[model samples]
Target: MSTTSTQPANSRSRVITASLVGTTIEFYDFYAYATAAVLVFPVLFFPSSDPTASLLASFAVFGAAMVARPIGAVIFGHFGDKYGRKATLVASLLTMGIATFLIGCLPTINQIGFWAPALLLVLRLAQGFALGGEWSGAALVATENAPAGKRAWYGTFPQLGAPLGFIIANGLFLLINFAMPADDPSQKSDAFLEWGWRVPFWFSAVMVIVGLWVRLKLVESDAFKKAEAKGTIRKLPVLEAFRTYWWQMILGTFLMLATYVLFYLMTNFTLTFGTKPQTLPEGGDPATFVPGQGFAYTDFVIMQIIGVVFFGIFTMVAGPLADRFGRRKTLIWVTSAIVLFGLTFSFFLMPRENPVGEGTYWMTLAFLIIGFTLMGLTFGPMGALLPELFPTNVRYTGSAIAYNVSSILGAALAPIIALALLSTGGGNPWLVGIYLSAMAVLTLIAALLMRETKDSDYTGDAGEASASHPAP
Candidate 1:
């Protein structure tokens, strides 16, 4: 504690706070687009003669970001590993802000025709590129400052940004929905699709400004600084990460699979299902007499907020659990839970109505609780787990690429897959649930197969340090 007093502690706290807040903003910007893709993009950017095709089109563009994420990881990973986490963090945020703001300014399909979607894909790629570097930088800043024994616990703090970012992004969207008039059957939803949909995108500019201010306050990590002092940083970080840490990256990608699916199910698929009249439970009958009647969006928002809180709580719990029981045990249990919950969620909880029926409220609560709880377990330990798997010299690039690459496979396509399955399988949540459950099982198997790295030292030379750290 006394190694570097006054200035160092103050600077570290500033750095951690900035890292957390900046990533939170980045996630929010990225998530805002995700929410729009599920809720409004079909109408705003990809309207088609056929309604189903329009939804599919929106999802295609949504998939575009996921596909671009791996590319972003490679490009950003090179810079992050070669340079330093701080510079990459700043650059990623700046790029994300610009892309998001451009998304806001885009004219609808009506104005720009097919070019609307084409240009939307480009901006989405930019968003993916920026986000690829943000999380690794944030994680490094927080974990590098943590006390040795408490690294896992402190590491969980940066990961909290994911749920927190979702809270902000979805919370804002809910607020806008309440304030706006898109809900009324008598009113023109077109008005919102044309102009109001842009509000969230436009609001991204504030996040960029605030994010830059906070990020600039951060100092480089002690680990990275030391590596620089020794002149040991990798020139080709992406290649190094793949050559040495590919197994960890693959494991992380799989481990993250269930968590990402759960998130998209809650945030995107639920919104799509909830708003669709045909999917509503109880034959499209509005429960106007119910106590919480006429508060459809409100209920979903409340449930998700509760889920986010539990996400934080479980993340806090995961740290100690990982320390006591080990990362493998924790991840295995969490992945199993994801499978079990996915079954219950996809089978019993999904709303059967076109627009979500009132009965769907209970399902929403069930899914929220299950998803958020598992999310806490998996995501909480991952911050420590990923970095611990690699050496400090390539830690940033290695972990960032792994994490974002997983996001591409697990999260980026989740909504599209869910929607596609629904369209093809007559809205059978069972099938979607089954698919998610299988991925969770694979994750559990991956966890079981990995060697435990909980007792490894991360402060030494790459080879010796990693030998001690191992894989699990």
Candidate 2:
């Protein structure tokens, strides 16, 4: 097998399309559940006399999927490393699509009692399991097939799925909300709780079909083919990955920690905090009142959508910048900014004394834009950086483990921890900001400890010798 087959079996268009479409669908499925978790699940799946308890229960189920992600990573990573990227990518997409569609068809708590939440948990785990494998495979497909010196730029295609999926999922929900007949435009309609929330999940089936079509047409990248020809493919990549590259795995996990924490806080925690009423409800006890900006749900989501636009734009921009300046330098600067951004959470998110005033709304919007801009800068480089941390033989397993473990540490607990901190701080977001800043500081340390991977060899069997070496 000539390792010099410069012409790949997959066209550039196909490579980009397959990776972008598959992840877009997968993220769409995940974000659909995320939106519903805040809006509908607490009411429909986990009914409680205490609204706070119900919301917490809903978030707990949301986090349960993170526990399953590492398991998915191990299973899918094994097959991805041993077999090839194409089959594993397709399988992950199918599993996620099926799980998402089934969640749409599930009975609510009103109809099926505890079983509703139980079934929802089962499907949510399946989604997490599929996603564990989804991101790494998509990243590999883009980076492994990239032209020389452009891997980081190619890598951003998969990362682009995050903002695109968020936009589509939230846009669909916003449209559904607007179309529904709500007695109060600020509150959720009965129709939205009963059935409208399920539309995004079912719509995922159509997207899966499209993703499968593109991915099925994909051929193995030359990097993987060369690795196989050299007989470097391990029978058990996960064991080998842990045995040899354990430090890389640890570094990669913490490298991603701030990104995950910032992202979930931007999306999920913001939704909860933004929409909570500033004043107590009529006849409500003063003791239980939680202060918030009191923006209507529709209005707050629109603000989020605006911020996510910068996320998408900056994600594309980070790729070229990373390629030019090196991943380590780019991440160091961005992570430092994230640390600073975390300190200002109270300054931006604090509601004015008049919560409904225009000044409060604009301040919240500014906070979102800045946070999401940082999100894009940090997230874009990770596609190339994580996979670059391992040899081609175990790239899938190594990168997937790092990414998913961070999901547990960062994403799974971010919303729950933020909410707890919010309550602990008497509804002020200073504590939540401190939490984000603390996570960014950890990521910054990890970045400083890691070597630059901009020029790492992708086709070579030897991993980066200096990967564990501290940056000067």
Candidate 3:
């Protein structure tokens, strides 16, 4: 893409494609590691004395990625704001692809002794670091290309990448499982850890090329151009975020807390807890899942596939909803729906025997729909909302800091905390529900306090708008 702000139809289309493709690739790499952490890394990399402890350790490594995210956000946000969105995006993609590919090449615990898990952690951190920079850059690309009246709609184009990435990731894993022999569980798992796991990570290399091709074809945003023209750009974008946009950043982080926690709970936590027989009650094993016979990895995988499909559907729906209903209202309502989702499905989805066999399957489907639908509503509008919260001079850095730092507070500890709650609360998954609800409640409050910014003109004076709106 050219580095000019010419509003050609071709330019807009190219920018949207660039944002969608890049974000999709970034999320794919990030979620691939998350899936591995839950399903394979515990056994392959971190071998603990207890199975649960091993899984916990794996989740900790997963969280390691989230922990590194803020640091990456700061570094990339600075360069993205100072240099440009395109440069930071390409660099982040390269970093993520290299880290993921190296992970595919790492030796298992049997081969490398203590270095196996250490290597896994190192690669995982790199993945987090890259992802931290990925979202905001992608968001900037789409919104910048968008017309004045349709920024949220265009912003949502990149948000679709989240669901699209999940679909591709889980669909690929499901395909691999189906291809493997059913009778040889050990052989299948061994192959998966030894080689099968590498396929998805290695595939990310192709995306880097695809993303670059699309991104390199797009023009920079009009807002950035205007900022550059006025010589109003910050020397230290990240530091400016801390000094001026600190309150907005804090509120944005908490505002996102519910969505992030619900995400891990629905995707990673459910997969882990659902597969373990012990997580289900003694006599209430649902027909769909037999705790002792076998936990339903395939079933849950299928559910996630279904979930991603709806997630895309709902994402499309949310754009117009925000346009019609206002972003804050949409976000508040969506978050409240998530709270109810947790309440309803927390216990209902647990494998339980009823007059009907496999009734929990329905519960699983219900939760999947509910979780994904709510995610679509809030996440779809968030790209526009966060950037609109700040001026163009500080937009890249300020929005990125809010987005990734929130990942640290919200998602980084979710799996660990949910598991701990499940383990300590006599295995009552309801406790996990409460935790999710609390985050949603916090987000609701933050949403209430936040000013609506849908009408803000990004191409005009962002500082003037900021003065009028004021940061919450």
Q: What is the TM-score of each candidate against the true structure?
A: 0.88, 0.96, 0.91
RMSD of each: 5.2, 3.5, 4.5
List, residue by residue over 252-293, the lDDT tens digit for candidate 2.
999999999999999999999999888777765666566777
TM-score of 3: 0.91
Question: Which portions of model 2 show Cα errors greater than 4 Å?
Answer: 1-3, 282-288, 462-472
Q: Write the per-residue lDDT of candidate 3 for residues 165-281, one digit (tens) a residue.
A: 888877777677766545644224655656887788888888888888887775556777777776666777776677778988988888788879888887888787666663344
Which sections of candidate 1 miss by over 4 Å? 1-12, 182-191, 279-299, 350-359, 462-472
TM-score, cand. 2: 0.96
Q: Of the candidates shown, which would achieve the greatest lDDT relative to the real structure?
A: 2
In candidate 3, stretches whose alpha carbon ends up further than 4 angstroms from where it belongs are 1-10, 182-188, 278-294, 354-356, 462-472
Candidate ranking (lDDT, best to worst): 2, 3, 1
